[model samples]
Target: MSDSGRRMRTVLHADMDAFFVSVELRRRPELAGQPVVVGGTGNRGVVAAASYEARRFGVHSALPSTVARRRCPHAVFLPGDHTLYSEVSRQVREIFERYTPLVEPLSLDEAFLDVTGARRLFGDGRAIAAQIRAAIADELDLGCSVGVAPNKFLAKLASVEAKPRAHRDRIDPGEGVTVIQPGSEQEFLDPLPVQRLWGVGPATLDKLQRLGVVTVADLRRLDLSVLSTSLGANQARHLAALAVGADDRDVEPDREAKSIGHEETYAQDKHSPAEIRRELIRLIDAVTQRMRKQGVGARTWTLKVRFAGFVTITRSVTTQNTVDESQEIIDLLTPVLAGIDPSPGVRLLGVSGSNLGTPVAQLTFDDVADERPDWHAATDALDEIRDKFGSDAIGRGSSIVGGRIRTIKRGGQQWGPDQPPSREISHEDDATR
Candidate 1:
């Protein structure tokens, strides 16, 4: 296959470079060359994104902020501005649409675009990738790395290979864009670690290690029957196919989310019931707000509680009616939270909504007599306030009283390692889900 046109299916995976930190640098040019971390600076805060300079000190996303500070004491930590990130992501998506409509967003920072249909108009895969990257750089002042390949699996892996790497003494500026031509897929994948294959999680890695399969070549050498016996037949077939670079998955555009949820790991465990309830209320509000934005409601709500020692438990309730209101969710979960034992001190709290569909109103007899304010109208008003002024422009009275309900405040500054986070930090364990 030549680079002139798409004789084979072409996919391009574009990932923003150190996305959150890069956006911050675009706004604050003074922080360009410095080690910067974008996340909550509190003891319990987790790193969302770290600049290449900061990563050299062994700091990266999802690592505890406390550990990140201990490693990179001089690093500048800033609370992230998610609203700004979302807006920039929308702009990036618009640019992708200009090239092709088959754009699948994996996150705010990355997406996969199937451009086979666009080759005639846009030259070819590599040319289209280059144009997209250039447009993003020129329009958004953001840096991105893209990978062009025959399939989504290889395209995503190539994007990772194209991203810059941080070393102890220096950073390696990788190829901004990489192309994996037809008939070169095996050559491109053979020497990589077996762990690089998608869906090879910790358990699968351990299984593969036991089989002495450390690289793609080793996985390829294993007989189908052996693999089928070791890892269940279905997964065995999946890995076997991937080992040979035979991914046929299409790039799905605007994929509907399976679930919506938010979680927070606290600096200190909450022993008081009132504190736990308040946090629960806050989480429900956040989750429902997102659901409303998506025009979906949840029939099931799951409450995740992590104890001090990392022992986690979840309680779920399915309602007859799909709910998009925070107060309704709060009422359903309050008893569930009350039933859980907090004597061990809860270290983390999470709420997730699932079994989603369009919300249907059921006029209950109790609801007719209950003269409560319209929660939907109230939330709409709150959303409008947030859209205009900012997320912190308004809040629930209970959430505002003690300031304990707010996590890390968005866009706040961190002067030093030990400073407390000024506001609530909302961490989504699985945004795509």
Candidate 2:
């Protein structure tokens, strides 16, 4: 194929292998070839990552730490080195940029890279995947899996098939790479079970199987109207399109983060709205601390409430000015807070800052000279004290007397690596005038 024609299959997905455990293994080489897990060491902590050896024992990510211990008592466990992992992920991104700037990160460990423009400069999609994987292995001594295909969907699936899985199941780990030609997507996906298709969760898979849809090939044979009755119109069409190996999503290189937030799943359900608000204040402190640390502010303050039934609803309010203060966030989110009927009890509570960018306010001359300086100076002074003593050194009186704040780091994902079970609905307002 000519260079232009070779562009037909140039998207590549690169994913690290057991990212957290791998990073930890670099320091604790003695644990190599042994079962190891990285996550919270507490009783309520969940698994974030598990080594292949640990996976064979049914110790996998998102499994409660207590259960993981029961499954593999001899496994070595550590909370994890997030700072080092992030640095390694940064280094890996730099390597991807060396081949293609069209890199879309799915998470800290996996990304999709569009290499159409990179073929002439590099070799081809396969060559670029090889080069990137080689760079990660050589420079960081890390194992990674790569998938090269015509689109993101197949690329992601190829990567998944290219790596190891739970219960000692693994695909072709040879070189940890899989490349699908431009027109072979259907053949590659047809034999795979219907459950492997995106959006086919356990419940959906059971529904599909009951309807005699066992594989992609079976799904492709169904009429649109038949599937629509069961899967909704939009989802039915979407799955049908995917079944035919049709996906046009682009590799977004500049997917800016829209918001930053922190939440906690309580050990037990909390019934008091006052208690829920107290947790919100504590969460606001962590979020604002991160905003200040990054020199980013927000024009909107948000609150997330997860009722006991796992229904999560988020409400956000835009302000006339930007803010990075805990008190200010509580004030802005009060209306939303009051609206929530906490009588049913809350399962989780969260706070966030959004409408990213430094806060802005309409300041008159007198306020700009006097009020702004004092407010800024006071917050700055508190920040310095926090840097010296710790986050607990400074606190708001309400938060201090209310309840103990749950402490988690911002160096990585706000929650455990595994996806949460709650359904999140965001309500946003226009801040621009």
Question: Evaluated with lDDT, which candidate comes out highest?
Answer: 1
TM-scores for all candidates: the values are: 0.88, 0.81
**Per-residue lDDT value at 7 in model 1:** 28
Q: In candidate 2, what are the lDDT values of residues 201-285, reduced to their tens digit?
A: 9888877887899999999998889899988899899999889777788889899778888887665577866666666766777
lDDT of 1: 0.85
RMSD of 1: 5.5
Scored by lDDT, model 2 comes in at: 0.78
Whole-model Cα lDDT of every candidate shown, in order? 0.85, 0.78
Report the C-alpha displacement of residue 341, candidate 2, in angstroms.
9.0
Which residue pairs of candidate 1 clash?
Answer: 259-433, 406-424, 407-423, 407-424, 407-425, 408-423, 408-424, 408-425, 409-423
Ten residues in sequence with the least summed lDDT for candidate 1: 408-417
Residue-level lDDT tens digits of model 1 in 289-324: 778878899999999999989899999999998989
Off by over 4 Å in 2: 1-9, 165-175, 265-279, 293-295, 305-320, 333-348, 363-373, 383-408, 411-433
